[model samples]
Target: MSHPVKLYVYDLSNGIAKQMSLQLTGRQIDGIWHTSIVVYGREIFYGQGLTETVPGRSHHGSPVQIVDLGTTDIDQDTFNEYLAEIKEHYTAEKYHLLDFNCNSFTNDCAGFLTGGSIPEYIKDLPTDFLSTPFGAALRPTIDAMFRRPTPGTTPAQVPTPTPVSTQPMPNPELVGSILQAVAAQAQRTGQPAASTPQATTSLTSPLHPCANSASFKSLLKTHRAVVACFSNVVTCPPCRVIAPIFEDLAHKKGLKSGGGAGAVFTKIDLATPSGQALGSEWGVRVMPTFMFFLDGHKIAEMKGADANELRTQIDLLLYQAYPPHKHTSLSLPAMQSLSLKPILFSQVPNLDAVANKLLSSITSVNNSERVKQIITGSVVPYLKSRSSTKALPTVLVAWTEVTSTLSSSLPPESLFPLVDMWRLALLDPAVATWCAANFSSSPLVTLSRVASKLSIQQCPRPYALTLLRLLSNAFSSNVLAPRFFIGNFRLEVIALVIPSLLHGDGSVRNSGASLAFNMAAFLQTGRAEAVRNSNGGGTVKSDMEDEEWEIEMVSAVVEAIDREKTSEDVVHRLVASIGCLLRLSPFYDTQVSSLLEVLQAKQILKAKLQPGQCGEKGVEKKEVRKLLEEVANKLCA
Candidate 1:
């Protein structure tokens, strides 16, 4: 027996604009087509977990439901706003579920709401459910919306003028006469016209107008348009006429479009613009430019275009990218390439740029496989051949994007080239500043990139303190794999970052302690020695005494810790690292005396008594005093 399907009306305005009916399929049916539901007006209830058991069910279960009234037609702006609200109101997984369900109502809604968006807010839910009946229903709507044309008045049609060939004719006499007329014109204009064989007559005669000449009449029909003003490049009259038409068309397409909503089409006029101005301003020297922009920033472009050719290019571009009205903030595919899981490395905002460039280069190389010698050359380098400054960053950024796109391991050789590219970016003060700025904004992402790069042995120079500091900061936030870095760096990144704990900046202090805690946890064995060797280069000789290495490293860490200020909460971390290190195999017992010296130097062992902290007459005055007494006894013993 078929269950009666119920209609779920969705009203997008108040946030709940749709209703879905579920039929019980089994004894205990739980899962349905989950999507991100916007529970705008739903009453939210929060309570602590119950300790006692319910009468018939497990006591562990908590009852909670996010009720969304319905979902309906929403423009891109409203859609983003809705999504942002949903993200704030629910967990990413929950929101992702809601998004899937919401998108399934219509194809346009699916693409509009989920397209080009970061799933950080929705990834945990079962993406497979996106194909469910609820999900399937929305697919058609999303597809339809995404397929809608970008708003622009249809291009005014122009009459197609007949094509005239400039090819030469076979008659020698006709060619001779045309040549003489060309010479006569050149003579009048005080310019020399070179002699041509009679067979080349068609070229010379086309420039002259002779009423009685059949060749001249034929030339008029053949050359429908002539250059009004001669120029070496594409400013010939016919091309110039077409250029403005394209410019106008691009402007109309770009009128209301900008930002990540979608790119707009624009034109950069070369002739109306002065010498080197267009090239300098827009970075081009060619004519008949056609550009695609997002919020006035040029992202993709072409130059030296004709009418039919320009139309083809526009169609191709539109096919690849949706218009603003049809777009969501970001595409799912593009956003996935930017996510943490598939990248295999830690996240870095700068690496996002790198990844994008790599993907672009890969695409270009693959696309041009069939047109090598005809275009740039068959073995066209995967990277661009522009000057080093232009090419290096592009290639590195591209590599980063590609690695993020590909879920599996990339070749070591492929990464070596990117390492060089990053090295170049690091050396360029401006580029380094940019990288640092991005790190500041998204520490987790930046730290992940650094960690991944290190894992691949990509750091070319002595690891900069700045790079280590960034990782340390990220570790402090507990936003990255602190153990990976702590185990990898030879020098105690924690020790260096620990001083930040005492700095004037409170955030720095917090970050420092975090780094120290994780670093201590990671330095379980002789990993520090390996790290030291990697960074400082065998400063500890292979033949050096094992006991001596222990003493040196312990002393270094203690000294670094002791240098921190009294107000800083670093003593706890220092003690923790020391405790962990001692518990690990290959103990550094010789450093015990050094550690005591450093502790004493910082007056860290000094006991303090608060007014209300006194113990009974027979008891120890303070915990520290009792502990110190025991320590003194041991040292003396």
Candidate 2:
């Protein structure tokens, strides 16, 4: 389990006849070739793009020979995903060569895949030949005429970079050393990393009732991620109805059960002078208003005596967080002290124009056609394209102004466009991150704020699905890995994600499964590293220690992963997520024993496998069965 990488080497042609190319014009140069990193075999061969990477009766006449490179502390699945990205990159013409072709790709891959490369002879052949003056003069000519394109494509001019070495040399230990989390992240995401410095912000803790509006305002200004549960025993009869639910939820135990301890909940009595002042500032006309605040922004409000409505808003706010306080309550220095990479905004153009229109219109007419058009047409497009540039304070300001005034800015009849704009904005990580950090406290910036009106029972399915997808995109920092577990972010998002996973929409379930995959995969990779560094060290034993949350998470994902109904992508990702959880609670790890028993992880997976599920080829059920079998072996071992 500690070191888990395997390499696949292919001799592309039969006999040495394939390597035919002598000192000059067409001499005996027989050789065998073609290679791919076989890191996670049956465990992950089911994903797309395997036709070329998987060794079989390939375009090359002969079958491939497999080699064991052993494993590294890295998660083999993630490492495989990283390798997939590499194979995708190398399939390009710029990196290929006649002497160094597929073997060269394998060499680079082996280095990245494990701490070893193929025996040096395969890589050295090209370098040694190109070094001699006689061979050097003919090398370019030979490659130009003989080097072929990948079966279907036209061959491109291979750039004259340094050719691969043909002289045999020992593979250096340092070859694969540079490959760690950063390289894997770079390849997995397919984009350059952010240049911003590490940023840290204080996380809000669960709160008790506020004594007065002054205390409420003071606490509110200090941190983002707060919820004010308003009530009064004397005056408001309806406030009394939802008061106990609000009080219990404001406590640690209630927040713990809900998976939103990073959020603060306060009881504000509207009867008090300070409560009246606070209510006036937020325009509170009702008695029991559950106001959700993020980054000092009021995102959603449920003003009613209905406990269910109040709980619904609280759930949404909690679901949007990362590492709920129950998980963080133990105070592990490794997790709590980790420095967070700043979620900087990609500065957009025309900030003033967008802000001016929304502000002026909201103050006067409440909602204007001109404001919606500019936001939908201009504001969102700019964010999509330039979201990675740098943090734009002015743009953040505009977002704050627009979101804070959202309720008063638009009437119910014309609210759809603004919600549409919000969903689009959520897709951009920079905008999403920036919004979460700077504009979250303002009610207007949260996706749920715009999406609050769209009920699946009342609206079209796509509307609800779109909102869920927006939530998924907002948590898409799984690409970077850092943003997924830094503080309370994932905890908040998971609260929202679990319900969507249970949603009836296949597409909604797919997005939810993907989000689950990201969360579990992130946790698994960290735990994998922990396994390597210790004598099987981890303290996640007992149901209360980690079981309640981990079980709920895995159970939700397993329930959503229906081989018969789910899409191929959904099945694959969900299976991978389950695989992640299985790895965390491997049969050998006593620490994760509680999670193993309580979730019945193995039993559920076995029950889901049907007769034809693993037999079909095009449908991913076959691969799903294979992956499930592999997981079963690990869990039951």
The top-ranked prediction according to TM-score is: 2
Candidate 1: tens digits of C-alpha lDDT, residues 174-248? 323432332222112122322321111111011121111121122223221211111123444554676455545
* TM-score to native of every candidate shown: 0.22, 0.37
For model 2, how does the per-residue alpha-carbon lDDT over 285-391 read when each residue is reduced to its tens digit?
Answer: 87777788866778888878887777677666655532221221232332223222221222233544544444444546444454454455556556556555544
RMSD in angstroms, candidate 2?
33.2
lDDT of 1: 0.30
The lDDT per prediction is 0.30, 0.47
Model 1 residue 626 CA deviation in Å: 10
Worst 10 residues of 2 by lDDT: 196-205
Q: Stretches of candidate 2 above 4 Å error?
A: 1-370, 373-378, 387-391, 407-433, 442-445, 449-460, 475-492, 532-547, 562-566, 585-600, 611-622
Model 1: lDDT of residue 63: 25
